[model samples]
Target: MTRRSTGATTMPPAPTIPKIPPAEVLGRLAALQTLPTPALKEMWRQLFGREPLIFNRPYLQSRLAYRIQELAYGGLKPETRARLEALGEQLDGGNVVLRRIRADSRPLPGTRLVREYDGIQHVVTVRADDFEFEGRPYRSLSAIARHITGTRWNGWTFFGLKGRPEA
Candidate 1:
């Protein structure tokens, strides 16, 4: 009898590459927004193999992260890693989510509007309880900002941590 034959052909899956840390991913999201053309996104896919994770979109955060792991970070340049780390601080400042462990509400607990006051970017911090600017009564900085600038900015405006003026 002829030798028994079994037909089977298979190729191995691609090697599992490391995931791009979420912080770096956020930095990429922020950096891509700075670009003006689609070319940047194309370059990103070619370099990193997927799109960046940006919130406020139709998809859930979990799904976005899963996709990032499934597709991105295969052949990314090591140089881009450092650049993204720096960018994360700039874009994702809201990453400062910690339990309440503070003594004084330094600079008051409110939004700090970055405005050009006296030819300089002066930070105006406000609190909801007793917010006043030059004898003008306002509820929050958001109110004053809207009154003066006529636009809404991100509400989570923070100057720095408690007692860290230089920060």
Candidate 2:
């Protein structure tokens, strides 16, 4: 410490942080199990060019490392992204109303639902617009279930297509 012109004690400015190469940063990120939260946040800012929405340690480290490697190497192509999105949409039934209404019980066409009741096997094939059972076309599975069980039953539940009744 030294005396300033005003006769007050002063200290030198903090040293600047050196910029590390992306490759080195990636290597460190790979090797380190944990990093300081502040450092991780800073890396997130540098790699993403924006502040992260999450501050969880593992999430921050993983996302920061991925961004660093992605920048140093390359990111997914537009075609790949589009393909992934299409696949997601297909899994989602390609429509919000269908997804919400059908839930997990909507099997793709050509799928088969097999069940055994009273020592007899039952097979139901999913069709594009209807279902096929015993060489006959049926519109609703509930009708098939009612015919088979001789009582009212939820077709999806009877065929194990649904886990629980929808609210």
In terms of TM-score, the best-performing candidate is 2
How accurate locally is residue 64 in candidate 2, as Cα lDDT from 0 to 100? 68
Please report, as a residue range, the 10-residue window in candidate 1 with the lowest summed lDDT.
97-106
Error of 1 at 86 (Å): 37
As a TM-score, model 2 comes out at 0.46
For each candidate, the alpha-carbon lDDT, in order, equals 0.48, 0.76
Clashing pairs in 2: none
Candidate of highest lDDT: 2
Per-residue lDDT of 95 in model 2: 79
The residue-by-residue lDDT of candidate 2 on 1-167, one tens digit each, is 99558776687765443445665865676653566788888867766667889999888877766766676657799999999779767866577776665555567778999989899999999887788999999887888898899999888888987764422
RMSD (Cα, Å) of model 2: 11.3
- Give model 1 RMSD, 1 decimal: 13.7
RMSD of each: 13.7, 11.3
Question: Model 1 over residues 82-110: C-alpha lDDT tens digits?
Answer: 78766655544535331112212324346
